[model samples]
Target chain A: MSSRRDILDLLGENARYTTEDLAHMTDFTESEVEEVVAELEDAGVITGYQAVINWDALETDAERVRATVELNVALDRETNYGDIADRIAKFPEVTSLRLVSGDYDFDLTVEGDSMREVSHFISDKVAPIPEITQTVTHYIMESYKEQGTEFDDHDDDDRLSVSP
Target chain B: MTLEPADRVDAVPPSGIRRFFELAEEMDDIISLGVGEPDFSAPWAAREAAITSLERGQTSYTANKGKRELRTRISRFEDAARDLRYDPDEEILVTAGASEGLDLAFRALLNSGDKLAVAQPCYVSYVPGATFAGVDVVDVPTRAEDEFKLTREVLEASGAAEADALVYCYPNNPTGATMTGDELREVAAFCREHDLVVFSDEIYADLTYEHEHISIATLPGMRERTVVFNGFSKAFAMTGFRLGYAMGPEEAITAMNRVHQYTMLSAPTTAQHAAIEALDNCQADVREMTAQYDRRRNYVLSRFEDMGLSCFPASGAFYAFPECPWDDADEFAEAFLQEQKVAVVPGSAFGAGGDGHLRISYATGLDELKTAMNRLESFIS
Candidate 1:
């Protein structure tokens, strides 16, 4: 049976426990935690790990701005696009990246203090990529909810309509 | 009886909120702001009405339209509270909740491939509901500068005015924004011109602190084009009870009733009895609760503002939409939990206009609200 510890890490907070800490939390042996982690990694589920930094740590002065860059790419250029995304994803400003359907191919979430910060990243970093053809940026004007894998309650029937 | 996959199949996904809540339950010291349910209990009179009905052997199924007393009470409540008049026998049909009324409206009025002009920063259910009814939804984003309230200008700008329908929800859930009389008048006029059916959700009507809630059905000629949806959930603090009703023109009501009769048959008889009392006797209770929500709403708005998070003052309902410190609102909300131990929903759950904002629900106790505020400050600062 799959460990309950592994389920919690996937569905809830991924950072809630270290391998050893999860072993303790779930009252399992350390080997059990290690085994679960290994299985998850082999399955390509536990892809990567990083620290979640506090927003206050990033800014010295001025307000914060967020923008979503919608990219359109063809299927034929998948390998080249992956290489481009890998390089762009290395930027300190980029937070999340997802391949989406509809009008855009890849949705890149970026944050900075001003529109210039976002524009500079797009022009300096993203636009230089070879496989990218079109891009549309949506500056987030307001938010109602945003919890990465935490509080999102998306139903399968979620509909998307373009804003003209 | 043998059933085909199409006949027996279910389409809507199971609610993720409840599943997440169950997961969070295993973690100790987790304070949840996940539920959209009210924290308050149903009033004693409403409870007593249910008990009385059981004692009087009123457990049998009611008429498909609902109990006559409940229907009459619903009509009076609409006329007295929202200035909308309807014939109890022809124009009012009790539903399981506003959810059911919303579903009935979509199922009855919408043809396949019809486009519904939906305001963004709307309740999560509206999109899914439209989809299940086989209609396409076109989102019209209500601006942050305008407090996320829907206006005729926003609707007109969508260029889908010629579409089949409009799904309206004010005293709205996620944003807590509402439409005023002037706005409703313009919407009514526009709908009349386009012959669009308006599904107006007034579930939070009595909870509005800024202005008296107005019904689009009350507008001249709007009764024919508007389906007014309301329930006991918000106003009477009866979310678990699940009693709601819809009012509209006789023809529309009849069509919706046909769907309701087959799908639901009738709402809970005990709930219907209790709902009648809620309509008749719970006005004062609603006022007191609304005042409490107003206090919490004001408190949360000020808290967010002081923390340098840009927030819009919520005009109705019990939520505060505060800007998060990250570009991805989801990342911000999750980081907040890791740092502050406070849980707030990421704005992206409501659709496009919600990025960079998080919704904080102030539906718990004053002390819990204060603790959440302090945790939020500690995290943000």
Candidate 2:
């Protein structure tokens, strides 16, 4: 019961943590941990678990190019930005989409193998949407950091093996 | 000419922990639960602040007392955290580290032949620090039965009631013992009756798990007589920065600064800038790091319980002192390292009341801790 949050926080940080590990880390027995996790998964609170990968460190052939597309859409009593947002969101390249307030109406991330591929997806798929008024795309060049993890920080435990 | 150590060498022995370090160096695949420091790096913003300071050519020595902004920030932080206020201008003297602050306290507060009663099974440096200051020390061993807390009864038994001053830390190192409010008041009353000036080293203040940290300096009449030592080393994961400070009566701080001026000149300029950022914006970072330590603490304790090994309910610090289930802790630690490849500190290194126990620091990664626990279980069984 107390471990529901502890499980969520632990699993959120590292998906590799197992039930036995979570049981030890939290105030739950192994069976109790399994029960709580199952309830969370059943309720869709435990949506999915995936690794936070440093994609840029991989082989160039496996590299991905991503961009944030600021989407301006025309809306009337008949059609809204949500309608067009749903249409653009169907493409697998559209990884994250949010209808935010401010300079942009619908901001989204589109990923592809190369900048040209991202540009092509925008022109072919995103531009075909009738209600979207304008699409501005900025290709991400390199990521120095992501999800609070540094891509280039090589911090070793250089401290003494034992200290007072 | 033969290079000889200073005259004080005969009085102070090399660190007891140093002997165990040699065997560990030659071992392969050792998972150390032995390190006494936090595993996390200093918060990134604080690191960036230092870089920005360096880039702006803020490289000169700071004021002997320290950067006023950092002191003011420290004053506000203490006021908010513990409701204890000090005049930042006269009461605070920044030093190179909490280690330096302790050394400064010994020099500024006491004279030769003055008595300093130290709570034992303590940090390795405290006794030696007092000895180097030329103060005769009386070791008051707080017991495992008392959760290693410094009770008035313990003081009465040790003849520390006659000492001029008492030196201790809550969320104590090695034992992880802390005094509750009522418990602290009892000790505070003792200090008052005994006419003992207090040097409360609260370096691990921000790391306690069971309750919000309570400082003995907060007790009535204690503000004027107590010197509170703290820093960013453990809490902010900023050990390498070597920035800490002492807050106390203006006279004591001024005297400490008198010595600090000639010896240290000032703490590193960029590190002071980094400390300002830490105090100004890193409260959440400290809480986050402490939460992580709490989780590790729970996990390690649970593992110890499963193995039927008894550990005092350590509510503070990143360590848990589990009584050795085997014959001798020093032998157990060496054998555990040799057989299981897991490194832990023999409690005897910390002084009296530490023998027959092992200090397991849970500041390592959780996965690594799990592996170490598994190895430890197998080796013991």
Candidate 3:
């Protein structure tokens, strides 16, 4: 079976379970969950761990703003993708990081309380590195759907299953 | 054809402007106001400058941002008109036109699925441009009572109050509405507060009837948030010349410059030289054109009123947007052409709120306009 079926079988049974719960439910140990998670991460199948928060219950005064940050970087031989990824991945507030096609090198999803906090994080923290050259940031005013977690289940075998 | 997996074609749509042009071409001798290109030619002096550059044999590609001379001229032009100061070397960039500048701005700034806010009944370019950049466009529809001016209330109501960027156009196309200096300052303040990057298209800055064009970038704390798009097309009558520029934070310009270099290399060599002359020697030409347009604007409005159609006096730009006497603007526009041989674009061609109106370009000769009005009167009656 494909790794997707294995992962789907896991999530399909219980989606809200913790990593430990998932290990227990699957009759595997917690160390096995860690191993599978690592394997999935390496295979580019399981992309992220999201904190699904109820905004109304979490913080009444919170004003969450989504901003798109375009970073212009100048990396040295020593400062490769791994180093740069490691540097940016440290910020818990950065929800997503993508290597895009075109003028900008990286596009970042930054969350903050206000515009000032967002700008400060980008200008002061993200842009000050020697490997970093420049940055252009834009705050999201509204979201039709804020990057929904919909796993596209494409069954390659199902198409061929009908074919001879 | 289906068997060849390698022969699959990209399913992209044609450019809005090109599609409009193609539609306009179908009708013979159609006096089209559909395409938003200036009817005037480049000034003699501006044309002379391009000739001079050709004589100097500058055919090779220029710096990605632009030639220092052209950027310097643009800097002076913005400073004189809107009191916004930009560093020619660091902040200003030349592109094929305002269209290309917009394209670069979005590609450099937007990621996939990023939402950008736009005012409705705007230039048709914004929607398609945002679509091409893999971003969603959230339109903030301006009311007729607001004179289609982009206001704080409009921004607030858009549900897009936090859009990644706001594309603003003033002395607007189709609707000839303009924003005052004070209004721009308020918008700038709002943008700063919301962390919205303002893509201000001030292409029609020179064509305002009663007031001066205000640059949002001039407002306090706005230099960092605003990327302005301007060109020689509308004001300097160099639409065919295809020269435009963007000015903003050095970081954005640097990113935008790379896109310009790769995609277009530079604006036409001749157009850039001509643009410099346009900045220098064409002030009188602009005044002359503005005066003629004002006369035509008033004439068209009066003619529409005389024919019992309601028309709000346009404050800027050369087009007169009059409410169609009939129910459907598209039907009226098509039938008028068939019966009276008068060509005007249905306002619906622009966007949603434009359904009941018709956009008539007064860029034609006065005699032709008079004949068109007479024909229109007879057809309607």
Candidate 4:
């Protein structure tokens, strides 16, 4: 049972770790590991697996732009902010959405092909939402770190040549 | 004029482990299980502390014994964990990793021709370090049948009673054998009866998986005679930081510090600060890493069973010592590396009892370990 939590933790760090790899790491049989992972996926414990990429390192010209858009919405007498949040979450570009306290009713992370597209999405789609009273978008300039992994600088193995 | 090295230095063989590393370096696409250090980097907090210290211009050499804050922290840590109390000011001496601590203990305590009894299939450093100190080493061979525990009978048979001191490492390097407190009591009694000083190397203390690691020093009448050498290398993955400490009777620590004062001067000032931070705040990180090592250790043990290799389950450390079908471990290791491209250290690299066994480290990523195991399966078959 504890292996379930352990698997999630390991996969959370690097989802690329195969079921076989996870089995070896967690001391579970390959089939057992497969069963638990499938159960996790079925139960919504594992929502998705992602590749944490340093986009700046890519040589391609077409780069994806990301921004965090905070929204302040009026709690509807009939349906609360959940109705508007549900509408905003349906956008394909909205990568993450969370109902948060302190000023913003919803915190969202949105991604698009370019900064102009992100701006267009906010001005065209987000602005038209009657329930949302205020919307603020902060375009991320650069990511020094993402998903708890550092990308700006590399950690070198500084250990001695022969340390026994 | 000829540049001649000392006869004593020439007598000791160069590290057998280094040869395999060199072979792996020259080869292409070798999956090496030969590394002894942890694959993980130092926890960010510890590294940040060192960086912060350096940024604050705290680069001057610390006192010969090391910073009082680190010593005090180590003292408190030992007291809480091992039930061994040490005076931060006088009973602790930080050195350049546990390697230096081992060296300092040998140099400070042993006179020329003094016999230092060391367990075989142990860390490679014990014999060479003793030889460098001009001390004679009596090999006490522990068997896989005994789970690699240094027995009273084995010690007596090896004539350890004639030795001045005993150098013991539990959750031992290469073997990964650990002794329970109850099991260690007999050895402790023997050490007491024989009036032998004990240099207990507990560097792998934090890596024990089966049971809690016990310090022989915590045994009755053992603290005064035992010098406990522990460090951040194996536990906190702070090998590069070069930090370790020795705790013993004030006199022994003073003696070690005397040599330390003349030689190493002091451990790295930045590392000492980092160690203080590690002891104070990194228990969770250590626990998490230890769990990972445990899983890997068990996985390797299971793999060894599936391969039909006789392996004693390692209770501590990150190595799995499995007896090979071949008689000559060195030849097997060489051939395996050359043919299969999977690198493992031969047991003979450690000492006499290490023959016919290969020490496979599981410190690498699980995927790499699985690949190595697959290749090993193919090679052995």
Candidate 5:
């Protein structure tokens, strides 16, 4: 049997490669490729495919502001921070949420249309949670790299056209 | 006035591997499994470091031995990983690439007619490089049964006793064969007994699949007599950066440095900076790339088996040399490329005893590799 993880790894790099292409790469027949992909989609292993865009490079009227908010949470015997974390995660504005070590209990990244929108997300939505004792927000200024990909194109690939 | 090329230049034959590359250059819809370079770009952090160095105006020739910081990083990296302690200041000399390091080692160690023992079905450079330096190369044909390893018996049988030095490449190019630590120790013992200098080309050290790469220099009493050549090309996907280094005795390093200084002033300053960054950070990236190579290697091996071709499973590097169905590998390679639009190297290009084999590189993207395999199946059938 061919590895399902290998298919996922290739898709993670470039989802645009066709099933036929994936078949060739993974040594799976085209039908087998389709079957494995369908299974992965049904199992929720592959939720969706989306483009990785550089928003800063585009000239647009509306721009998104992103920030990481650290929360000091108080936990009780039952439910604990799970209930509150689930509540925060349910918000469409929350991009990622995680339970972190040290002074903060939950570290979250939230994105909004503007700086005002992000501040409003903290004051109106996040701060209102009773279990959250305190919150600290840090806005992302610039990104040199994200998701294991470098944004800069300064040094191009320099391998010979053909070499052995 | 007409000028004549040097007699040595005329004596050396043109590389057989270059013919297919030249043919592919003229053809459209050609898929090449010939090139040994990684299809992936250099890690972003490494590229970014070069850019940052340029922005900071750090463009000039570096110290003849390379920047001190980079040397120290190489020393530390070797020491931590392989227990090889090379004083960066005295025993290491940065080179343009492992190619240059190999050339320099040959030039420094060999005088006219000095005999050098080399394993066959290896990288294409060793024989020609030795010949260019006026050294007579003694061929030791490693068989497929031995998994292409250089054993003491092979050396003794090949008249290595008369040779002044020996050169070996593990995770060997073309064959993709690698020697284990114990296996290498026996070879090291033989070298000691013969008092022959050893040149170890470890360009593919980081590309090993199943086991950790064991440098011969790390063996007992061999460090002083061995010159280890490694580079950023295969490992970091930094072939264009042209950065490599040699570690050995102070005297040998000094001699290599003397040749390097005269031929090449220094490796690019920007590449040196990027190499430092690659060593300091980018372990995760290296692991990611290596994982991809392993996946491809396994896929190729299984495909070869399914096709009923006899292939020695490669435990290192990104190449697989499988016995071709035909008797003459050169004819098979040329015909396959011409008819199927897929390119592979004839095993004979490497050296003696490589006939009836084809060298396939899995360094291309997975999709391309798969396509190449399908075309190969059609060609064979």
Candidate 6:
């Protein structure tokens, strides 16, 4: 009946569960699991299967720094916040962008290889855009949590392997 | 110059599950499905309440029959969940887990030479507990056909009529079987006919999936003779708290409380505080955990079926009792552990009619359960 909901719930917990595993776990057969997944995709409910990684744990030289920029802009008679938001959202460095209320017109999160690169992006690229009255950028120092996951903490299932 | 233990203690054999638990400890990277408790941790609200109580120096022992506040809450909780009522002060006696409650029930209701009929394949503690309570045990085998439920036919065939009391567990451990309301009515009539005092263990009452648990004690003419034992361990993920309560007639509860006061005194005050919070605010958590177990239960059942092993349709608790492909469950379980690094309890450990099967628990994460099932399928192949 609610096979779609069952599959979605299992995948939502761990997106890496394969179709074969889903079949064994669910009442749906292997082919049925695939069909359900395809149906969900077609309906645009499932956009992608993502791996949530802790970027700070990597030991690469190109360490990324993230910043949240609040953009306060003026809307002209012809140009509105939607047009300006679209222009800023197209930047490769922009990871998240939203039209926010209160003092800021658009709130955005940007990631770059270094602080200098991110600062240069806001100064050169963002400031040049017309209708941009003010900008405030705050670089994240440390992440305690993100995306419903606690940072720097690895989950260990401490239950004994077997009991009776 | 030699010391000898009590004869009765020496007479009873040690548990069969202990051997597997020890062997599993020595092995490396063994994925186990033998767990008898929930994998989830205790609710945060309960833990927070316990901490607050402890910080306030609430370290003294509670009343011999447990705290009045907790008992009132338990009484109300039972009334709401099962429509069963207890007079909080005289009809409810909280103990240290259902284990102690079983022991107290045996001593309270049965004499030293009296017989205690127990349903098999039952929990590991019942037989030994009966022995420790100085009562004779009669085993009544409940088959998969009966949904592991005790019935008139099985009871009559077992010589339980001669026994003074009976111990029954629903949403049974190892089997994960439950009794429907109609089925329970039939058993109640049987008990009434034989004048049997029943020790109803409903520890997994809140863990039942897809159906509301109907206590046998709720049926007419059954409450006076039944002592329903339930606890915080299974449903609330509070196994370590070691708190349980027995609800029954005033006479039996007073008798149980007398023994409890002289021997164990009372359940821990900290655990009682946690339990109070758990009963008050953790309904949603209990429902969520039950729903999670239900999904994993279906997944494990399908895996066993695909492997050509027939499993009882377990609609309650978190276990799947499936027939072992091989005749000897012990040999099959050992080889499964050795070859695939996966551990499952041999069904024979649970007693009569439990042979030629395996008890697989589904109270685990979906990822780990998937891995264990994959390993099991490969081993069987």
Tens digit of per-residue lDDT, candidate 4, span B198-298: 99999999898888889998888998899999999989999889999999999999999999999999999999999999999998999989978877786
Q: Which parts of model 2 have CA positions greater than 4 angstroms off?
A: A1-3, A60-65, A113-120, B1-3
Alpha-carbon deviation at B55 in model 2, angstroms: 1.8
Best by lDDT: 2
lDDT digits (tens) for residues A82-133 of candidate 4: 7887898899999999999898888999999999999999989997888888
Highest TM-score: which candidate?
Answer: 2
Best by DockQ: 2
- Alpha-carbon deviation at B332 in model 3, angstroms: 1.3
Better of 2 and 4 by lDDT: 2
Residue range B101-193, candidate 6, lDDT tens digits: 999989877889999999988889899888888899999888877767788889899998888888988888889899899989988888899
Model 3 clash pairs?
A140-B162, A140-B163, A141-B162, A141-B163
- CAPRI grade, predicted model 4: acceptable
Candidate 4 vs candidate 5: the TM-score winner is 4
Each candidate's chain B TM-score?
0.93, 0.98, 0.92, 0.98, 0.98, 0.98
Which of the predicted structures, 1 or 2, would earn the higher DockQ when compared with the native? 2
What's the DockQ of model 3?
A: 0.00
lDDT of 3 by residue, B220-295 (tens): 8888988999999888888778889999999999998888888888888888889888898899999878766765
Question: Which should have the higher DockQ, number 3 or number 4?
Answer: 4
Native interface contacts kept by each candidate, as a fraction: 0.00, 0.73, 0.00, 0.21, 0.27, 0.62
Give candidate 2's root-mean-square deviation (CA, Å): 2.1
Q: Estimate each model's TM-score.
A: 0.67, 0.95, 0.66, 0.93, 0.81, 0.91
Q: Supply the global lDDT for candidate 6.
A: 0.88
Q: What lDDT, from 0 to 1, does candidate 1 have?
A: 0.76
The regions of model 6 sitting more than 4 angstroms off are A1-3, A69-88, A98-107, A122-136, A152-161
Per-residue lDDT tens digits of candidate 1, residues B212-288? 88888888887778889999988898876888999898998999999999989999899998998888888889877
For each candidate, the alpha-carbon lDDT, in order, equals 0.76, 0.89, 0.76, 0.88, 0.87, 0.88
Indicate whether candidate 2 or candidate 5 has the larger DockQ: 2
